[model samples]
Target: MAALSIGIAGAGLLGRLLAWRLAREGHRISVFDPALGSEPTFDGQQAAGYTAAGMLSPLAERDNSSAEVAALGWRSIALWRDVVAALQARPHFAAIGSLLLAHRGDASAAQRVLARLAAEASGTPRAQALSAAQLGALEPALQGAAHAWLLPGEGQIDCVATMQALHDEARGVRWHWQRTVAQVRPGELVFDGAPSQRFDLVFDVRGAGGRPALPVRGVRGELVWLQAPGHGLTRPVRLLHPRHRVYLVPRPGDVLLLGASEIESEDRSPVSLKSAVELMSAAHSVLPALAEARILRLDVNLRPALPDNEPRTEVAPGLVRINGLFRHGWLLAPALLEDALQACALTQPAEPLVAA
Candidate 1:
């Protein structure tokens, strides 16, 4: 395959991942994102990954996602590791599996989640039903969780570190940080107030920034970080609730990534008090120790999603537009990238996101 000059317009998770992948293929690559910066501020926030719990859970998402999505996630576990290994950068990856917790009153919620995951098994992984004793054995820190389901093989990643590692590894790629791309066309990219450039291929991955051109709607998501070392668990936990679902991703340095609230609107404001209180209360219910955790900060961002809440890819003569990842950015990125590569005839033949 011949290397081509490729210009990527975005600095989000997908943008950064694709940049290094293309660069490693020996292509001339340049990337731009408005929120690109050296550090994610003292508040520990970035435009994309900082607020995400980064759960790479395929089976756990079986309820609302298409079979294609579940398959894509099933593939991303290996693809993510391969992508990271190809760059030789260390990112936090915990494949110890994930937990689905439901209180005594929510036995139906836990059963429903388990049943849905079981039915999606068209070669996808399965989640094991767990008794209270089993759950306690796995995560000793969790309390007040009577019934649970252990989604085997699910995991998480530190999105911030992955991006940083990619940045350090992709030394040859040109980075145009803090630049907003106004227009993108095949072989052409027009910056907001800079000279336009031509390339062999142009990638429009601006997330919500390219909404004018791409068919993407912004879905706001918010997460709360806490300084809770002793409250940390071994893996990600998804607690089922009647109103909203809560996920807690434990990170190094005794920090807990508690998220998030999903809303239909595109509002970027701080979390509403109702949602914040609900989230905290839910967390406390799952792990009583969380009551003592110090409040760190509230993080909010909108995920680009289509009406179907599924990711998509569009390819033209010299342009490729990928978006609508929504909340599955981490779980589906590799498969979507494979689609992008297949579209460009840059990848060897492989199975579809889900075999027919």
Candidate 2:
């Protein structure tokens, strides 16, 4: 097969991943983003990737996602392991699994989660019910939780570090940074206040920026990063609640990411006081150490979602659009990239998988 020239619009997580994948296949790739080239201070204009909890929890996500997504997410974990191994420098990541806990009052919620996990339509979404003793043995720091479940083989990634690794490893691709893409057409992109450039294929993974063109909505998520110093949890922990499903995913150097509040609004404002209080109160309730953790930063981002909250890949003549990753960016990216490659005729069946 001939190497095709692919034009990618959007330099967020999807764009960077797609860029590196194609470039490794010896294809000519050009990435155009409005924030990359000109930003000196790393102001995240197209940066939803930077704010995610980076949880690669396929089983944990089955309740809120379609079976197809669950399947894709399960596959992505292996792909990510390979991709990270091939990175210029590996990012801070862990596959320690996760603990899904619920207080005695929320035991019903925990049971509902268990029921949903049993009913998951795809993937080997398995979990073991945990007694308080087992839970304490798993996470000795946790307390006051009567019911819990241990999800094995799950993991978390520091997306901020992974994005940088992807960017650094994406060698030999043309970058058009700080250049706004007005319209993505078949075989070409219409730039804002500039001449249109043509390519053999176009990839639109612009997240919420692809807005009215794609039927995508922005769901607001706020995450709080804490400097835990000497008191950080060993692995990611999920606390089940009536209104919020909170996760505290740890990064390297004693940093704990406490998140997140899922609201149905696209308001791009700072974290609300009400949300901070609610998240803090819930996390502190589960992990008492968080009460004394140093406040690092509060971040708010709008995740792109379709009506079903599943990511979509559209194939057309000389064009492919991938979006609606909705809180599953890391979980679903590798499969989505493969979909894009197949859509663009870059690879076919019987091709050997790319190994690190």
Candidate 3:
């Protein structure tokens, strides 16, 4: 295949992922993102430290996502390993699966739905249903949980590390951090105060204003951190509820992350007092021991989400719009980027989207 020059906007997970993949395929790539360095903050707090950490779980997401979610997720899991491996510093990958626990009243219904969904996804890797006893045994730290669902093959990646790796791994790609692209024209990307260069393809991946048609509204998610007390569980745990779903992920430095709430509004920065109280109470309900855990930090940000919860990839001749990753940017990035690369004729795989 012939080499191509590609311009990618929005240096977040998807934009960076595509840039690295295309660069690996020998395409001349240029990346632009306003949030990369300028720290020109948005969404109330600084956007520099935010991450899309959760991976894609097909069975777990059956109620909220399309079949495309799993297919892309499986492909991403395989793709991320290679992308991460190529980096000078490999990012941490936890393939220990996700633990989803529902409250007692909602346990049976959610489990039945999850089990049926898992059975339907039999050919693909599946989420295993767990009895209360099994759930408690697997994660003894968890209490007051009536039922659980485990997606054995699903996992998570540190989004910050992955982004860093993407930039570091791009050998020839030009990255213009802190540059806000203000205009889009054929064969050229124009940053507000920078010279514009023509290219063969332009990708509009700007997070905030990238795609207007996508039912993507910003969802505010806040996470609270506490120093871990050496729990033996080696994976991420998500406690389910009707009003708020909480996830506690184990990180290095004896830190455990607790996130809850998907605040649906244009205002992305406000960390509601109501939400915070609800989160702490929910975490305490799951594990009373958490009451003693030392609070480390509180973080809040908006995750891009689509109403249908499906990623949209549109290729219109010279330009492509890739946005609406929703919450699975890390989980679906590998496959989605692979698809983009193939569409651009950068990779000559057997199932190439464009003829070489």
Candidate 4:
């Protein structure tokens, strides 16, 4: 395919990933987003990706999501490895897998998760029931756990680093920062109080910003970061409960990301006191060491979702709208990129331009 002009709205995970990939394919790409550019002080709360803990657990997610999502998540994990390598930057892609824990009281919840996983016939690694000794060997930090399941091959990525690297390494692209797209149509982007811009192809990855144009609603997710020094969690750890599931992801600098609150509201307000207490309390029950951890930050962002909560791609003559990723933005992005490119009748570039 010849080099064509492409305009992408929203510089979130999907937008930036699409922009970076298409630019490498020799396309003249331009990106528009209301958020600031990739600056040293870029706030993570501005986009949903940065606020996410970046867990790529297909089996864990399969308990609540569809089979298609789980399958795509597995594929995206492999694609993410390649994309991270090509970026040549440290995004902290850890394939150490994730651990699922349940207290004696919540044993039924864990059993349901196990039953769901067993019903599905997949090529991915099966979840293994961990013995007391095995759980200790795997994650010694997790205490007071009645039962544990180890889902191998699941992983996580540093969303902040990944987004920054995508912005820094993208070539042959023009960036329009702080530009909110009001309308996205085939081959044209209309900005507020500005003239419409035309392109050979247009991608509306505006997420919740697409609003009424697309049947997308904002699903609020809350996360809390803690500075837990001397903690020894190597990978993501999820604690299953009857009401909600809490996860703790280990990050660099002796920090831990605790999250798992999903609310069906578009409110972009700060994290609620009730949610903070619930998340911290649940996480503390699993990892007693976290009780001494100091609170670092509380992040709240809205994930784009449709009524069905499944991601959909709509294609027109020269337009492609990808949205409704919900909480699976990072998990499903790479696979969805492939689907979108196929929808556009384009193939991946044989030689990508990586940062040196």
Q: Order the candidates by TM-score, highest first — what do you get?
A: 4, 2, 1, 3
Alpha carbon lDDT of each predicted model: 0.81, 0.83, 0.69, 0.87
Off by over 4 Å in 1: 36-38, 41-46, 348-356
Which TM-score value belongs to model 3? 0.87
Rank all candidate structures by their lDDT, best first, as comma-separated numbers. Answer: 4, 2, 1, 3
- TM-score for each prediction? 0.93, 0.94, 0.87, 0.96
Backbone clash pairs for candidate 2 read: none
lDDT of 2 by residue, 89-122 (tens): 8897677789898888888778888888888664
Query: Which 10 residues in a row give candidate 3 its minimum summed lDDT?
Result: 40-49
TM match of model 4 to true structure: 0.96
lDDT of 3 by residue, 1-356 (tens): 67788888777767777787777767899888766462323344333235443544555666566777867887777666666666777777767678887787986667666755664454776667788788877788787877777778777666566677777776798888767778666668876667887889888776545545345566667777678586555678777767776677776557677775776765655567887788888877877777778877666776676676578787777787776776666777678767875785656665432224
Candidate 3 at 101: error in angstroms?
1.2
**Candidate 4 clash pair list:** none
True lDDT of residue 258, candidate 4 = 95
Model 3: lDDT of residue 10: 77
lDDT of 4 by residue, 1-356 (tens): 89999999999899889988988878999999888665523233477877889999888888878989988999899889889989867688988789999999888878888999876655778899999999999888889989998999999999989998998888877999989999999999999899999999999999988888888998888889899998999989999976566899999889999997898888888888999999999999988898789998888888999989999999889999999999898999999989889877866534443445
Which candidate ranks first by TM-score, i.e. highest?
Answer: 4
Best by lDDT: 4
